[model samples]
Target: MKMKKKSATLLTTGMALTLALAGCGNGSNNNNAASSAPASGSASAPASSQAASTGNGGSAVEITFWNMFGGGEGDFVDQIIKGFNDSQKEVVVKQLRLESNEYYAKLGTALSSGKGPDVAVAHVDRISPFVKAKQIVPVDDLASKVGLDLSQITASNLQSVTYDGKPYAVPLDTHFHMFYYNKDLLKKADLLNEDGTPKLGEMTPEGFEKTLAQIQSKVPDIQALAVNTPYFQEPFLNLYYEAGGDILNADMTKAAINNDKALSVLKFYMDVYKNKYADLNDKNPWDSFSNGKAAFWFGGVWEAGVLLGDASKNIGAMPLPPIFGSQTHWASSHLLVVPSYVSAEKQEASAKFMKYFSEVGGSTWGKAGHVPANANVTASDEYKSLPYRDQFIEAQKTVKFAPQTDKYTTIVTTIAESLQNIIFGSESPEDGLKDMEKQINEVLDN
Candidate 1:
């Protein structure tokens, strides 16, 4: 949990190592950065794979659960699987860690070859291809037979996992972005109330900018914020949506990058970097965040994990501040999903264990830095007990999700690269957005 400040040299090494692994599908070994995509908001053609195998139910209803998270996260998933298997009389869950970065590629190969796990972890957009292929079964009936209602899950998260019309997975946690402020620094700056808690909701972009000016004057070594290009993407999208920018047309046939509202959001974000409100050049924002230098940053839950123990002393989070709308946060979820290749017997078993897996996995998953969406766990004493829970949970409720498509992963890189160029002084917001629209349309056309 002791995250070292990734120096230029260390970053070079890590990037070289991780980029090599990227060919194998991982962008980062860090789970918070590991994964996501959206449904096109339109229907695709029927699947090619046959559904409803007619036969007696298999005697062995062992379900295989494939996970990409390792280290503490992997251990936590294992514990959940162990608990489910030990507590249940009929279903057995087999949990496996696929070390390769090529998670989806390998998964695609496996499912097509009829060798994929019964319950493999796939992101929202990632499930589109599988769902269209009809490799996975619909869970409307599965949930009914087991008495687990899909209504319990957040509507957006549920919709992301649902293809044409059926639930394919249960979203586990919402990884929304929140603003982490240094409590000690806030107190030092006399921003705290008589009650001693820092007044965060009042900290608007302008108000926070003034605070940063004071922090800069007093703590010369600290940065106002550390800008991670990708971390800022969702917040920018949130701002775009608030400012009236749609990411794509309702049909998902055209990109909305050229819209005035989207361009406005992009310009505002680039201005943050250009105006010296944040240090944009750092390869890792958390380093600037953890070292007592960054005043505020929009970071994911994994930021909490790497800052476990002593590192947590200086950092605390508030919901993302609203720049353009009533909505004030941006988030994505880690969903618990079933694969197309999973046996019907295993799907039946998985349904029975969904809530339980969510409960047992909740505390640990949260401790690993995500906010659990499991109704049981979120209501539990442990979740309410966390310091940032109240604020973060509210933020999670309004988190935004990408348009889901089988091609989401492939499409994201174009947007990511375009964003990097705009943030790093390589392109203008207008130019960058133009590039984004072009690249996005190219993907849609394909």
Candidate 2:
């Protein structure tokens, strides 16, 4: 994923264009920059009038959908879309895939030009910018029309995509970092509890180190703690939030993470690699844990899809250890939203699809290692019975996200780079904090 250095400026221009065009609301065709065809879909359908359905008992309204998923997650989304097509006769959704790095840019351009897909998947964090710019309309009306019950969705996920008490998107799932342990390795270390969970005595830095040392002493050839470097930012942010600090000020105009609390959090993370409890150079944490070479793995819940398939390894998940005195975890979500300027039939069709995904497809989506955003789905016996989900599903109530600003892409990129520098020992924790604060404040100022 190539990230723009001047993403703050680029995002601002895209959003401004959206606000300007949203006022038009005339549903006129215009230039679309996202039709590069980097990926395939149902068909080469134009963003024109509603397509007449020729399938079952009635005319099915055809609607286009765009999404930014790949690998297993992509397959899961495709399966759900296929299920919808198979179970419905009133709507036909044409799904299009796009490169994630450039998704927002293309989406903003298309919506501003009145030529975007009728429905699209947006990150809960990224939807704020589109909502603020009015590129996506409020979906409360649609929710009401479809008899969608807001109480079924998690409050955090529902609030994440809402602005000024108005809903902008329908949440699909909540993805967060969780603690996974190899049950066999834990049993060998005598750290496996009777409940099939790891036996860490206490949730403190000293206690955590002691538990890791015990595991290391038993499995001398394996890493006691394994974490994927690419997703290090998630745990890092979780630590920051746990330390009673925040990523930005209330006004979202300045960085709020340059204080002692934040520094202490960074030092806590640095000590993990400094004391030799974990290897910072391990490139594949998931493989390390799944292959029984690692005792503990901290990563996104999405790994369940792959890890659950390893019959030789027994895996157990738990909420991240509350060593920092806070139960909060870093999280994000996939949300369904309608773009501005679309036909009434398209709106109805899109709303119906959203309802189906949240109501009918929630359980299937959970199999992809995501906690369903719908509360009923999460509480269902089928969802709770899934391996390792019961251990971490409670995290939805305390999950935290970065501030909602139009410059979100820039802020996260800057913070991720700073964390990587610290993890790779290219920069000291102090230097990393200074760099993060400077870069984040600069983006906020812009």
Best by TM-score: 2
- For candidate 1, which ten residues in a row score worst on lDDT? 37-46
Q: Where does candidate 2 stray beyond 4 Å? A: 1-43, 46-58, 309-311
Per-residue accuracy of model 2 over 366-421 as CA lDDT, tens digit each: 98999999988988999988876777687667888757888888888888888899
Each prediction's whole-model lDDT (CA): 0.66, 0.81
Clashing pairs in 2: none
lDDT of 1 by residue, 160-215 (tens): 77776778777777776677777676666666666545564443455555666676
lDDT for 30 (candidate 2): 25
TM-scores of all predicted structures: 0.79, 0.87
